[model samples]
Target: MITYSTVKSTLIEKGTRILKVLQFGAKTADECAPFGDDSNPIANMTAIYAETSTVDEQVIIGYINTKQLAAPGEKRLYSLKNDKSISFYVWLRNNGILELGGDDHNLVRFEPLNQGIAAANGEINTELQKIQTAIIGLGGAYTAGHISTDIDAAKINEIKCL
Candidate 1:
């Protein structure tokens, strides 16, 4: 029989990682034609360009629970960030938290925080009663979003878990 305090401790112990974009959409060109092919008109078409970006890891904080689990209820809380704005939903499982929405019963009860804020107060108590069982750390993973390239304009300042 696991308790809320126990689950909360596990999530805090595991902590979270933030992903930052080191380089956004950098481009590079590759030459497909060989020296001998340079004289051919087709050689002009051999140049190809591709765009890519680099990312780094940072730290974030958040919370978790089993109110949304389908069977043996489980829950988790995570705080991670990337170069983009993201939205997260609860994931409940018999074992551990994982991608949002599967056999587990998803609760659309939670809402996003206001601008520049990562968490809000008093929201957990309202949903805590809905949980049924202790979550085992087997299949849990946080469901996150990539706010699109255009919106990822600045570096992440902070991530607070409540």
Candidate 2:
């Protein structure tokens, strides 16, 4: 098996650059000696020794378990972050649960539903209000105002740094 190491901080493109191997001993030159001299290896390793495979001050660690599960049940998970900041963090459970955001207060759990997440808008909220009103009109002892207001576009917007 060929082990890949990064001698310095590297940048990985989203759609390009194939990174199928695990990188170990990042920023540690001694670990790269066994891999032999590299004319030009992954992450531009031209030096005789190895360096860290940090992408934008974030280290990418990958794990592979071939014998853990069947081919169809295989799963891959990744978490990228640094001491100062977090690049990306997510978890996928074996029961098909996806959790995002690292902390409990900020974390958002997405449970499986018949129809995935719906877009935030006024129409759905309006319909929901009507249903609540109808339920109350039928002498149902249920509290109302769960979805009091509709979410408008101005209240939320997509923001991407890069």
Candidate 3:
């Protein structure tokens, strides 16, 4: 039988990294900007909107990329992705959005593709759970702690008696 602790530990260790990436916007060219060897075109327009609470004080900014030379009245607007959800605790700690003793809240918008990414992430997590169950089964009850140490010892004594 599967125990809550076993699943909880497995989920916490294996799921955290996957969840972090799925929840936060992946570090990609689109998010980081300056696709190739080109310099940042929006450097002049970049403005720091907020600073994180972490020791490093990572800042979030608003900027306009105008290297492509858009037509008059046509300008590019950058926004966060919809599927990635930043944690309230992390946001508070990293973004400094809330004061040290203040209540945390959602200060950023979700990406447009958030639904699709979230669904995929859910499927992956479910698959991991199934895999863990199969592994424990193959390794036997002792491998998965389905039987208590006392019961295992008792079983060993019965086998020794035989």
Candidate 4:
């Protein structure tokens, strides 16, 4: 009994807006450096890149951890965890990919080491059928008999009332 919207805009969620308001920080309680200190915030060379963020995620151009000398290349120096139980997104570690929020709480990033980029998004490609619907609305992919060179006398006549 689930209902879905047919409108193009409604089908697509406004991820960019969420990405804009999203705050990046360490998973630690203090929300600071890997060593649990608020002195150093920007440890990894992580930064936003390529148009601020993609429609699906926020594109950053820096490693997760490659700044701190303690645990070089250990993990993302900084990350956002849904400790507040916010059902917006989740932090993915083993895969180095944070995906849309779900019913799972395993790990969060609270270190400072490397340099990389992060792509944050909510429900990527949630509706695959939407693409097909768009294609159909556009008059389908192609047809052989109905479509022909306008230079053809019969084809031209078919298009006109003549």
Candidate 5:
């Protein structure tokens, strides 16, 4: 979810240009601006504005390119292609808008997902649940207190769900 803080920051920094969340559907890739001698990326500009909790303007200010221009700590620009509709969270930069990471929130940003450990825990939880259920079915002494431990419970509960 987009948070109020994100909107506030964008407004403070961009002054006139505001952040917008947009959805583009069934698009085709075309040649766009070249980054260097070898990298020529494709882009699409057709999009429909998505409503935000904080901002209500429906107009899209600028075109969004498919190429991802990496900032500091990034390796290189990776161009994106759109055939089906996709949502973009963007802000104005260099006379055009650059796509921010795909956080569809219009008010507050959600914490990033930690898939590495979560995946392992989810797998363990699934197995634990199966074993617990089987023991109870066989009239064993397994009870609710024997449920999965914290190692198995610390998966996706804290992350906001769409």
Candidate 6:
């Protein structure tokens, strides 16, 4: 059996050029890595890897399963700011969640339709109105009354950096 690490090692040689962006057969992909079939070693394998040598930033994204892929399950990227300390995993048998340990915090699951989050958003609108009023109070002279209220991107003619 070709181990996942072994496959990656074979494809990417040490002291070779680092990949800038890579995306697997996509359900989703990021701006850094666009989705494509990059001549997968295995007939139906799907995987991607991207790296920026300047800041040593790297991202790994994948989607492989029984029908679409031969090796392992898909993986979302997890990258840190440090170089020579990055790690990648490709051995998830079934669909699962990826967890990270940081600041002694516990795992958090999110629901897009959660009611609590919805309720909080209601209050956010009223608070935003107050912020708009405050910015207008600054007495800046412009055709637009206030930046917060006049948020039409096309109407924005001039911008000044302070």
Q: RMSD for all candidates, in order, please.
A: 28.1, 13.2, 26.6, 26.2, 19.3, 17.6
- Candidate 6 — which pairs collide? none
lDDT of 5 by residue, 17-62 (tens): 3332223322111222234433221233333233335453333322
| Minimal lDDT window, size 10, model 2 | 107-116
- Indicate whether candidate 1 or candidate 3 has the larger lDDT: 3
Q: What is the Cα-based TM-score of model 1?
A: 0.13
Per-residue accuracy of model 1 over 1-162 as CA lDDT, tens digit each:
111111101121223211121122322222223334321111111112222242321121111221232454655323223321223444555565454434356322112323223222234332342231212234444333223122243434453232
* True-structure RMSD for candidate 2: 13.2
Supply the global lDDT for candidate 6: 0.36
* Model 2 clashing residue pairs (backbone): 6-51, 7-51, 27-51, 27-52
Which pairs in model 3 have colliding backbones?
Answer: 52-94, 52-95, 53-94, 81-111, 82-110, 82-111, 82-112, 83-114
Off by over 4 Å in 2: 1-6, 11-79, 84-87, 103-148, 154-162
Model 3 residue runs over 4 Å out of place are: 1-111, 140-162
Cα TM-score per model? 0.13, 0.28, 0.20, 0.15, 0.20, 0.19
TM-score for model 6?
A: 0.19
lDDT of 6 by residue, 86-121 (tens): 243223335553334222454322332244455566
Task: Give the least accurate 10-residue stretch of model 4, judged by summed lDDT.
Answer: 112-121
* Top of the candidates by TM-score: 2
lDDT of 3 by residue, 36-149 (tens): 522222212332223245543332232333234234544332222223222122112333333322354432223323555567667766776677788877984322222111
Backbone collision count in every prediction? 14, 4, 8, 14, 9, 0
By lDDT rank, best first, the candidates go: 5, 2, 6, 3, 4, 1
Worst 10 residues of 3 by lDDT: 1-10
lDDT of 5: 0.39
lDDT of 4 at 38: 29
lDDT at 154, model 4 = 26
